[model samples]
Target: MEVLGRDVVQEWECSRNVVPSAFDSHFHLDRSGRVLQVYSLERLIGHAEGPVPEVLVQVSDGVAVFCDPATYPEVYPCAPGFGSAVGLHPKKPHASVEGAVRLVEEELRKEGVVALGEIGLDWTTPEQEWPLQESMFVGLLELACPRRPVILHLRGQDRYSSEVSALSLRLMRENTSPTQRVHLHCFGGNLDQVLGWSTAFPRCYFNIAGSVAQFDEIQRAAVRRIPLNRLLVETDSPNRRVQRKWHNTQAYVGEVARKVAQIRQTTLDEILQASLENGRLLYNL
Candidate 1:
C-alpha cells in the first residue's frame, strides 16, 4: 500500500493539474449476495458518462466493510487489496446480542480486519426494536472504542429530521472515550450535528459520499465548513445512487469528489489528496 505524507502533499501542491487516485473510505463487499459482482477491484473503476471526469477511473484502494457477521467468511478472503470492518448492523436484528458480539470478536482476530463498523443507530426500523438495536450498538462500541476506528451508520425516520444521530451521540458519549476514531459514514446531518460530533470526539472524521450531491442548504453548509483535515470521501458501493441518473459504482467516486469541491469551493486535487490522507490515518493503513 502506498501511503501519502508531507512530501506527496508538496508534490501535489507543485503539480496542481495532477489528479490523485481516490481511497473510497467506506463501501460494502457483500451486498444482496452478489459478492463476486460487487467485490472485484476491476469493477471499482466505472466507465460512465455525465459529471464524472475521465481521470477518476483509477481507484487505487479502499476499505470494504462487511457489516453482516453471517457473510464474513465469504467476503473477507475475497477482498485482496481492500481493508475491512466487521460488525452487526443496527437495522439487522440478530437473535442474541452476545452471540453477535462474539461472532464479531472472532472476525476481528483475523488478518485483514481494520475497523469495527458500519454500525450504529437507525430510526427507520420498527419502533419496538429500538432497544435491541441500542443494546447491540452499545456492546459493539464498548468492544471497539480506543482500540480500533469505528465506521458509523446512522439514519433517522426522514432526511429532514435526524433524532437518531442525536441518540447515537448520547450513546457514544456515555460508552466511549473522547479520543475514539470515528467515521460518520454517509453523513447527512446539518452543521449542528457536525459541531456536536467534532466537539465530543476530536478525532472523528465525517465522510461525504454520493449523498453529497443531494444536500439541502444546511447540509451543504456543513460540507463547506468541514475542516479539510477532518474530511473523507467514500463510494458506499452498491447502495445509493451518485445521482438520479447513475447507479453508483466505485468508478463514479470522482463525481463525489467533484461535488465536495464544488461545495467547498476548493480544487479537485485538494479534496482528493486531503481525503486520501484522512482515510489512511483513520483506517491506520
Candidate 2:
C-alpha cells in the first residue's frame, strides 16, 4: 500500500539503510484473501512481518505492477509503483471485450504505465475458452502502442505441451509490430523453443522468477541459453513462492539471480548487475 518516491528512497539510503537496485519485474500489489493476513513481503524477505517489505523501498525503483482489467475497479488507483502493465486476464476475460479495451487504453495514458500485458494464452483452461482468449489477446495486442512493450503470460495445458508457446508466438508475430518489445513472463519452456522465439522475435526478452529455483534440468538449460542482456528477474510476489512456508517478495529476486548465475556458471553480483540494467532498459525506467 506504500509507494516510495525518489526523494524518500534517497532519504532512507542516506540513513545507512541500503536499498538494492534490483527489480522484481512482475508482481501483484492488489490481491486479497488469507495470504495477506498470514504472510507478507516483509516477513518473506526477513524483515518484520508487515503489509509490505521493509527493504523493498519503492515499486518505482525496479518493480512493474500488473493491473488486471477484470479487477480494474478494485485494483484501480493503482499503487504508486515504478511502472505498470495493464491487460485483461485470459482465464477471466472481461464481460465485454470492448469495455475492457477502453479501460486498457485509459491505463496506458497514465504515468509509469509502461507496457500492455500479463496478457496472452493459457491452454490449461477448457478448450471451449480458447477462442475467446485468442480474440482478447489479439485485441489487446492491437490496442498496444508500438512503442510500449508487451508482457505475455503463456501457459500450456501442462508442462509437456509446447503447443501453447508455439501458438502464442505465432499470434504475436502476426498481430504485433516487429519493432514492439515483448517480455515472456515466467518463462518455463525448453532451450530450443526459446531460441526459436528469440530468433523469431529479436526484440523479445525473457523474465526469470523465484519459481525458477524449482526448474527441472530442461528449464535450467533454457535459462542458461538466455543471452544475459535479454534476461530479467522477478519475484512474482504474493505468488510463486519458492516454498510453501516462505512468502515471495521482490527481495527474493536475489535468489533468482543466484540461480541464474549458477546455471550460467557466473557470479551472483554479475547476474544481479546485468539483470538490474536489463530491467531498467526493458521498462525504460
Candidate 3:
C-alpha cells in the first residue's frame, strides 16, 4: 500500500500542469445539503475557467454537522474527491467547554475525519461569551494534541487590531505542543503578526482566502511575508464571497493562488504546487 501510494504521488508530480486538481485547504458544504456554488469539479477541470480548483479538505463545524451520528455520515461522507475536518466552531453553542472537548475528541476518532478544526476565537461575539470561547478553545486545543492537525478560525476584535490573534496565540501556546500542526484559517492580520506567529509556532501554516482580494497594504504585506511552504489556499465557501455574483467555492481557490503568487512575485503554478504540498503535509493527506 505504501509503495502504491508513492507511485500515485509520483504520477501526480510528473504531470504538473495536468495534475487535474488543486487542494482547497478549507471550505464548507452547506449543512442544509444545498450546493450553493454553481461550478462543479467537472466544469473546473474541463474548462479551466474562472480559476480551476478542487476541494481537498472540507472542514465543517463539529457541533453543527456531528451533533447526530446517524446524519453525520450522510452529511459528510469521505470520498475519492475530498476529506473532511470535523471540529467545534467557536461560535457554535455548547453546554460547556467540557462537553465541547468530549464531543471533539470523539469525532476525531471517527474515520474520514482528517483534522480537527474551524475552531478558535471570534471576537465579534458578545463580551460575556468571551470566557466560554476562551475556555472552549483551550479545551479543544488540549484534546487536539497527540491526535490530528488543527484548523483555527481566528477573528480580530475589530478591523484595526489583532487582539483576537494575540489571545488565540497565547491559548494555543499554553495548550498545544510546538510540533502540533496548526493552520490559521482565512487569516486577516498584518505582516508583523504573521512574522510573530511564524517565529513562535514554526509548525504553523496560514491560509489565504478569496477575501484577500479586498485587503489593504498591511494584509497584502502579510501575504508576501508568508513562506511558500507555510501557505495554503481556501475559499471558506458560501461565505467570504469575493463578489456579489460569486458564491465562494473550491473552484475559486485558483484566484487565491494567483493573488499569493503575485504578492510573492512568483508564478501561479509555483504557488499552486507549494500550497498543494503544504496542504498534504498539514492534513497528513
Which candidate gets the maximum TM-score versus the true structure? 1
lDDT of 2 by residue, 1-285 (tens): 653211233344564344445666886654522345423232222221223333333233454455565444332332333566777667878766677778788877776567888888888898999898888888887786567888888888767248888888888889877777888888888987778788887878888886777888998888889988888877776677554355555545666777778888998768777777877787777
Evaluate all candidate structures by whole-model CA lDDT and list the values in order. 0.75, 0.68, 0.65
Model 1, 132-204: lDDT tens digits are 9999898877677675998889988878347888889899989899989988999888899889999999999
TM-score of each: 0.86, 0.82, 0.79
Show the colliding residue pairs in model 1.
46-251
The weakest ten consecutive residues by lDDT in model 2 span 41-50
How would you encode candidate 3's per-residue C-alpha lDDT over 58-83 as one tens digit per residue?
Answer: 22111112322233453344545356
- Candidate 3 regions with alpha-carbon error over 4 angstroms: 1-20, 35-75
Using lDDT as the measure, which candidate wins?
1
Candidate 1: where is the Cα deviation over 4 Å?
A: 1-19, 32-39, 42-55, 74-81
Cα RMSD for predicted model 2: 5.5
What lDDT would candidate 1 get against the real structure?
A: 0.75
